[model samples]
Target: MELVSLNATHPDHGGKSFQKAASVVLHLLVIAALTYQIRGVARLPAHPHIDARILVPYAPGHTAVVHPPKPKIIRPKEEPKLAMKEPPPPPPPSSGGDPTGDADVELAMASFFPDPKPDLAALPHGTRGDIVIDIVIDQDGKVVDTQVDQGLGHGVDEAVLAVLQTWTFYPATKSGKPVPSKQRLLFHFERA
Candidate 1:
């Protein structure tokens, strides 16, 4: 058998000129795309100039001086004083005289007891009443016992009793000698 040429430019079959032209065109297109991309990357955006003096190394005798911020001082403002009226003086004690008919024994006065305002929040608004309590004062001028003869409820009675227990009284005197005595106290509670 004769040797047959397998060259791409053979005349028995159509030459591959179309393929060669297409390859040349493809190569040209790739070169064009690469050049376009490189040209776009070569351009740089405008930016502000930065001073690099702080990055410089300091010399032996020339040192950089840095100052710390000063501290702030603050002062408090004064509050205004309010004008309020003083409470009225307590009433004098009743002169019911001693039950044993001891003329020398003086009864306890209303002023001797402290005037602690009861917590009226438990009671209705504008509620007012009297709470009578009988207290025994020892010869040492301390309340030894207390009995609620009358009470204005809503926890007011307990509050009053607790405050009275801490009070120190002036003991009664019989023939100029200190003696334990029993006295009745009247506390009037009025809501303000």
Candidate 2:
């Protein structure tokens, strides 16, 4: 019961042959710092130029010099000239009569009718006719343009041009100011 002595030598430590010569000088200073970092990474010049190419098996005429990659001219960016200030000369020719000349306009007074009658009950059970629309009212009385000019299909001319585009007219005049006329709406789609 007394065999314990791993090459026994210890004056407080510094002994097994000075710890085997300090572990062989710390393994030769870690192999001389790993051979000075592998000779400074083998003198450094190998970033990315390794063309050891030797693939020669397609022998018929040996044509592989392909170098078509130099067409990148791309040049279209010239757009910065916006000083246009000549649009103020077009609003002085509007004093009453030739508001684009509907030629003496004067017949557009059916004030507003958000939906003044056009449900003909979805017309189909007999669908009588008559849809004629030609509107164009606008001088600010809106009804800008309808044009159904006699349609009466079972859809009742698109429900009387969608109820005459929510009709809103009273702007037809010429010698008396507000112009822009032209109105001829007669929608009668009786479908009892």
Candidate 3:
């Protein structure tokens, strides 16, 4: 018999050639892939299945009704009203505080005692001192007796006494009876 070539010759024009070893490798990969596919299909279960789940809402068949109580009526009590009295007007600002030393005495506008020193022509303005005078008043509210307890210079004592003579006080009373009362008078003399 004539010698026949067993090698499969690959066509080549400066191209790659598939050797015998490379062709054997490709055939082995294709057979492995087909065999794995067939084995995977055979391992599956005989019947196909689908999972199912159900949800339902709750319903109340019966419920009792509730009613609120009615509100009660309230009435205010009758009260007798008394007549309102208006308070006396506030005292003038010129007068000094609590001069008579008696809170209950109603001196009104005619009250004595200066917050500032009174003017004295004999002495210079801004002369600072006080002249105390003991005043004795009869039941008639007239200055009956006068005595100087202390004196500030420049005849201020005489000037204060002169003013005291003209003053008419509310005669002091004890237990509703007019009584002779003596009160100390302070004459404050300050500069200007």
Clashes per prediction?
0, 1, 5
Most lDDT-accurate candidate: 1
lDDT, candidate 3, 1-192, per-residue tens: 988687856567224444666778889887665443321122113334633222122234533233233556676597768899999999755422245453433231224532433357777766778788888888878888999888886767776787778777677765455667777867667666
Q: TM per model?
A: 0.44, 0.27, 0.38
Worst 10 residues of 3 by lDDT: 36-45
lDDT score at residue 68, model 3, on the 0-100 scale: 32
lDDT of 3 at 167: 79
Best by TM-score: 1
Better of 1 and 3 by TM-score: 1
> 2 or 3: which has the higher lDDT?
2
- Which ranges of candidate 3 are over 4 A from the true structure? 1-121, 124-126
* Residue lDDT tens for model 2, 21-138: 9999999988666443221112213534543323223334565443433666877699668897766555554443544664544666887776446566665777687767787877
lDDT of 1 by residue, 5-87 (tens): 77645573445777788899999988666443221112122333532222233345665444333556675597677899999
**Global lDDT of each candidate:** 0.72, 0.65, 0.62
Clashes of 1: 0
